[model samples]
Every structure is written in structure tokens, then in C-alpha cells.
Target chain A: MKIFYELGRYWIFLAGMFTRPENFSIYRKQVMLEMDAIGINSVGIVSLVSIFMGAVITLQTAYNLINPLVPLWAVGLVVRDSIIIEFSPTIIMLVLAGKVGSSIASEIGTMRVTEQIDALEIMGINSTSYLVIPKMLAAIFITPFIVLISMFVGIAGGWVVGELTGVVPSLDYITGLQSEFLPFNVFFAMVKTVVFAFIITTVSSYHGYYTSGGALEVGKSSTRAVVFSSILILIFDYILTQLILI
Target chain B: MIQVQNISKGFYGKLVLKNVTNTFEEGKVNLIIGGSGSGKTVLMKCMVGLYEVDEGAIEYDGRDFSAMTKLERKSIRREIGMLFQGSALFDSMTVEENVMFPLTMLSKMDEEEKRDRANFCLQRVNLDNANNLFPAEISGGMKKRVAIARAIAMKPKYLFCDEPNSGLDPKTSIVIDELIKEITYEFQMTTVINTHDMNSVLMMGDNIIFIYKGEKFWSGSSKDILNSGNEQLENFVFASKVMQDLRRHLKN
Candidate 1:
């Protein structure tokens, strides 16, 4: 019952954010700022994690293929598919669900507790649209680009590790990467990235916007934003994969 | 003028404001005084449209604020400026930017005009040489002054302040109270203040209302407050030993 209530409230919150902004230029400036915060600031961590994950996947794949008849290049195929189809979209977003999600929650939650939100409301500004919509727009616009970067870096990491460790011949790995490559898989990953971005921004903003009490409650809201966003991302990952992939 | 007519509000079925009605006249400092949990803050918030009243109507001049939709209320909201208990300055913005925020969002003024207006407001608050400073870097008194500057930047016709002197030292509280009073008279704005600071009540409450446990218990000027002859009002007004001594001296 509480869950239903929360879901209903979440929809209302989303609806409230879609109203016409009080000032388009101010909102545009805010969107640019949020893009920097949500996307630019995140590039370092996403790249670091993707590179290591890709390397590990390549090495593990090479190790597990004990059957001599199977081509060594199969390791590259596995690494490429894993990074593009799942790792970049799902894993990178889960990382962002922790980083970006917590940030949006804590920032807005502090504003709510301090009455800055109340101040905006009293000024007749749509606080929901002013504060949250910019973040949602930034995340939706930039997360896909970040995921694309992750895909490139992850594939590059696999190639670098394959060359250095002699796990598989570089030529064969490249051949495996080119073999059976599906353009639709990249499109599917981007679709998932877009969905995850929406989930992260909205869920986090909802937690922050409705936050009551003081500092303790703000911290709790941040935690809840990250937790709920990650959970929803995983849930939707399965749902999207079923709908789009299967 | 702002009129709150028989407004009531509740949370989770527990009443916070109970059919309270009052008029806050324009060009005067109207103070709502009560102890914590007495519903004074709630009343002020409802009047500002932060919380919807469960009953009755809030009117700004003749317009029914309670009946207006959010879009319809924007015009009135633009005329309302609020100073929150904690100052509520945007943490990410500098002091000048904070004061300029409403103008940047709601006004058609260009960059130079907005900057000049922000500077003028900050100067009016005696907050010089602090424009570039962030809220976290400023003292509590400075923060309050900056908040005052921000509130008045739009030249609002209605100003609502919630506990303006909450965490200030008595001397700073008096300074804030004086600023509020000066601005109220100078701008001729309808000023509504929510506070429990007795000093503020006695000093600047041109029109005062006392709420007790979600109900309006008394209404009068500060001159009349000392002799209201209401026991609850007396108990609250003379709660401190110093006030009791003052009351006794006055009686003699």
C-alpha cells in the first residue's frame, strides 16, 4: 500500500516538473551546468571502470576457452559483445546511479531542508521544473554520449590487454571483433542508456524534492535515491532486454 | 494589505492551523508571535501559498489567493518576497548572484540593470564588500542581511519573513529587527513576520497577532500587548524573569 502511494506521488512529481518554465534562458543555463556536473564530471570514473572491466573480461574469456577447436579470436568476440551489449550501458549506469544520483539527491534535499525550495515556490517559480527538469534533460542528453565513450574505451582496453599479455593474437582479436558485429546491438545499448538516465535523474530528484526534516533526512534521501535508482535500472534492464533484444 | 480569513490546515489529520483569521495592513510591520508548535509559521506559509489552507480564503488586497490556481497565483507570487528562518540563500550562488536571482528569473532587465539593482539592494542591507562571498563563508548575521537583500530585490509589495532573528545574537537580532522595520516603512509594503523573539515583538510589532496551539489567542499592537488582560497572552509575554520584572514595574 505504501509502495502504491509512493508510486502515485512519483508520477505527480514528474507531472509537476513538465510545466512551462518561468524563464527559458535561465533554464537553458542551468541545463548546461547540469550537463557539466552529471556528464563531464563522470567521464573519469566511467572510463577507469570500463577499461578494467573490459581487460578482465578478455583475459577470463581466453582462460575459459579450453576447447582447442574453438578459435582464440572468440575471446575478442565475447569481450566486444559483453562491453557493448551489457557492460557499458548497464554497469556504467549503475556506477552513475551511485555518483550522479546521490549528488542530485543530496543537493536538492539540502535545498528542500533549508527552505530554498520554499523560497522558489513563494516567488511563484515552478521549483520542480526549475530544479529537476534541467537535471533530467542534462542526464538524458549526455548519458548516451558517456556510454558511447565507454564502449570505445572498453573495446580499446580489450585490444591493449590482448596485445600486451599475448592472450590472443591482436590480428585474430580484431577479426573476432569484426565477425558477427550487429549495429542493432549498439542501438539497443543506447536505448537502455536513455532509459537508465531517465530513471536515475527522476528517481533521485523525487527523493530529494520530497525530503523532510533536516541533515539526517537529506542523507537518508540521498541513500534512497541511489538505492532505488540502481534497483530500477536493473529491473528496466531486464525489461528492455526482453522487449528489445529477445 | 493581506487578509487571512478563517484558514485551517492539518497534517496527517492533526490540525496545525485552526480557522485563524487576521488582517495584515499595508505599510506596517505585522508580527505573528507564538512559541514553537503554536502554528504561527504554518499560518505564514499558508498565506504565502506554500501550504494550501484546508478552509477559508487568503486575500491579497481583493484577490482571493486561496482560490487561484498555481498559474493564476504567479502574478501575486511575483509580488511576494520571503525571508526564511535559515536565510535559504542558494548555496551554489554568490551573495550578489543570490540577490539577482529573482530578477534574472522573473524580470526583463538586462545584465547591467540587474547588477546595479543587486548592488543597490546589497548596499541597502549594509552588506558591502561581500557580493562575491558564498553563503557558507558568511556569518549568520551577514547571511540574514543578504537574505533581506534577496527578498527585496524584486521590490515585492508583500514581504513574509519566517523567524528572521532565529539564530542571531540579541544585538544582531535587534539589528535585523531594525532593518525589517525600516524597510517596511520605507517600501510601504505589507510585511508579515513570524517570530517568537520577544524583543522583536515589543520593538516593531505595529500590528501583532498571537497564536496559541493552532488558534489565534490575541490581536493588538505592542502598546496594547502589555495590558491585554488575557492570561494566556500575559503568561506568554511575561514568560521570562526580566519581562516579569518589567511588567511588575509597569504595573506599579
Candidate 2:
């Protein structure tokens, strides 16, 4: 019951934020900037992780397909299937929980701890929209872009492993990947990305936005943001997968 | 004008402020003086809607703040400005950005207008040349100046200061007090300051409300404070040796 009340209050706060034109105006510019900070700027870490993920998927698939003359093309098919269906988008956000989610938390949490949030209240500004909405929009709009990049890089990483280990010929590997690919799988991944983005960004911002006390409390808020958002991301990943594919 | 009427707040079933009611009028520094844990700060916060009141209501020009919707309350909040004890400037932002923040967030003014207004406010607070400096690089006094500049950037109708004289030297305290008073007069703002400093009470206390154990024990100006004939008021007014000497000089 208390949780529902909290959610209801959050909705009211958000509603109040959007109802004002001046406050919503701040979001337009701030969101674009935050998208670059939390989303585009995460390219290096996402790419590096995607490379490893692809290599690992190829290795696991090769071991499974190695039984008594199973075709190498089948191994390529499995790698593409797993990468498209699950690995790239979901794991990337889990990694983002550490990088982007924590950054939002600490930044906002410190603002709260230091009374900057109160300062905003006195200035007649919507601190939630000024601080949270920009980051929220950034997370929702930019995650799809990041996930798209991750998928491409991860698939490329698999290709590297398949060729180097001679698990599959390059031409046949590429063909198998293309043949097994379903357009709807990519669409589903994008949908999941949006949902996950909303959950992670909103939860992380919420933790930071309401932070109280001193410096220690800000640190705790950041940690809570990453841990809670990451766990929820995994849980929702399964639920979405079941809903989409089953 | 802000009229706090019989406002009380409790936390975890423990009463913190018991029926605090006072009027902080426009263009005057209204000081809420009390010892630590006496609920001065909490009472001021209750007036601003930062904390909810358990009983009674706060009125801004007779509009009951507690009965208003969150959006309506927020609209009132936008017309209010605050300077926190810690200065509370954003560490990541430059002084210019910190001052410009409220205008950027709240005003429909163009960037140039915002920049011009921010610069003008910084200049008003004698921080014109320090616009590029970060809060960490500035002195405590300068940080307070930055906070004042930020607070006034929006030209709020009400200004609240919590511990405005804290952590500063006697000289800087007076300087900040004078600045607050000057701005209060210039803007015709309803200024409410919470302080424990007897010096501040005498110096900036155009209107003083003394809270003793969460109730208004004394309501008078800085002048009447020394002669209120209330023993507790006398003890508090003469707590400082300097004040005692001054009181003695006044008597002589």
C-alpha cells in the first residue's frame, strides 16, 4: 500500500513537471545533452564488451556443434540466434547499469545531499524535470541506438572468431547468419530496449532525486541505483522474452 | 507577506514544532531566532512547503498554502528563493551557470537574456569577475555570495535563508546580513532568516520572532529584545558578553 502511494506520488510529480511549458522546455535541450553523456559516450565500453560476448558465443556454439560431423553452418546459426534474441541488448544495459545508471545516481544524489534540489525548489524550477526528465528521455531515446551498435559489433566479433578457429568458412558463416535472422527478432529487441531504458533510467533517477542526508547517503543512492536497476533489467528481460517469443 | 499560523510538525510521532505562528512581512528581514533543536529551521521549512504541517496553515497574502495542490504550491514556490547554510552551489557548474540555472530552468527568456540577467545578478552580488570560477575555488563568503546571487536571479517575491551567518566570520556575517537586508528592501521581498546569532538579531532583525521550545515566546524588533522584561528573552539577548556590555552601555 505504501509502495502504491509512492508510485502515485511519483506520477503526480511527473505530471506536474510536464504540465509546465518552461520546465518541459528545459528537458528538450537537457535531454539531448544527457543522451550524449549517458548514451553516446558509452560506445567504447559497450563495443569492447560486445566483442567479448560475440567471441564467447561463437566458442560455446562451436563446442556444441562439434559432435560427430554436425555442420559448422549450424554453429553460426546458433551464435546469430542467441545474439539477436538476447545477448547484445540486455547485457549491454547491464553493463550500462554500472556506467550510465551509476553516473545519473551520483550526480543527482549529490545534488539532493547538497541541497541543490532545494535550491531549485526555491527558484520556482521543477528539479525533477530539470534533472530527471532529460536523463530519462536520454535513456529511452539513446538505448536503442546503443543496442543497435552493440548488435552489429557483437555479430562482427562472432565472425572474427568463426573465421580464426575455422569453425565455419567466412562466406558460409555470413550466409548462415543472414539466413537464420528474423526481422521480428530485431524489432522485439528494440521494444525491450525501450522498456529497459525506462526502467533503469527512471529507477536510477528516482533514487538519486529523493536522496537525503549527507555524502554517505549520496553514495548509497548511487549504489542502490545500479544494483536495483540491473536486477530489474534481468528479470524484465526474461518476462519480455517469454511474452515476445512464447 | 507570509503568515505562518499555528503551524506544527511532527516526525515519527515526536512533536518537533508545536504551533509556530509568525508574520514575516515584505521588505524587512524577519529573523526566527532559537537555539539548536528548537525547531527554527523546521518552522521556516514548513512555511515554504518543504515540510507538511500537521496542524494549521501558512498563508502567502492570505492564500492558504497547505490546502493548495502540488502544482499550485509549486507555482508559489517559484516565486520563493532560498539561500542554504552550506551555500549549496553546484560543484560541477561554474558560478555563471549556477546563477543562470534558475532563469534557464524557469524563464522563457532567450539565452542572451538569461546570460545578461545572470551576469547582472552576479554583478549585483559583487561576483561579476568570478563568473567562471567553480564553487570549490571560492571562499566561504564568495560561495554565500554566489548563493545569494542565485537566489535573487529569479527575482523571487519571498526569500528564505537558513543559518545565513553560519561558518562565517563576524565581519562576513554582517556583510551577508546587510546584503540580505539591502536586497529585501530593493526587491520588496518577504525575507525570513533563521539564526542563533544574537548579533544577527540586533543587526538585521527588523522584525524578530523568538522561538523558545517550539513556541513564540517573544515577538518584537531588535530594539525591544533587550527590554522585553521576559527573563528568558533577557538571558538569550545578553548571552554574549559584547551584547551584555552594549546592554550595560544602553542602560547607562
RMSD of 1: 1.1
Please identify model 2 stretches exceeding 4 Å from their true place. Answer: A1-23, B234-237, B240-252
Model 2 interface RMSD over true interface Cα atoms: 1.8
B1-252, model 1: which lDDT tens digit per residue? 999999999999999999899999999999999888999988998999888999999999999999999899999999998999999999999999999999999999999999999999999999899999999999999999999999999999999999999999999999999999999999999999999888898899999999999999999999999899988888898999999999889879
lDDT of 2 by residue, A162-229 (tens): 89988767886787786746899999989988988887888788888878888899899899989989
lDDT scores for all predictions?
0.94, 0.85
- Looking at model 1 chain A, report the run of 10 residues with the lowest lDDT sum: A18-27
Best by DockQ: 1
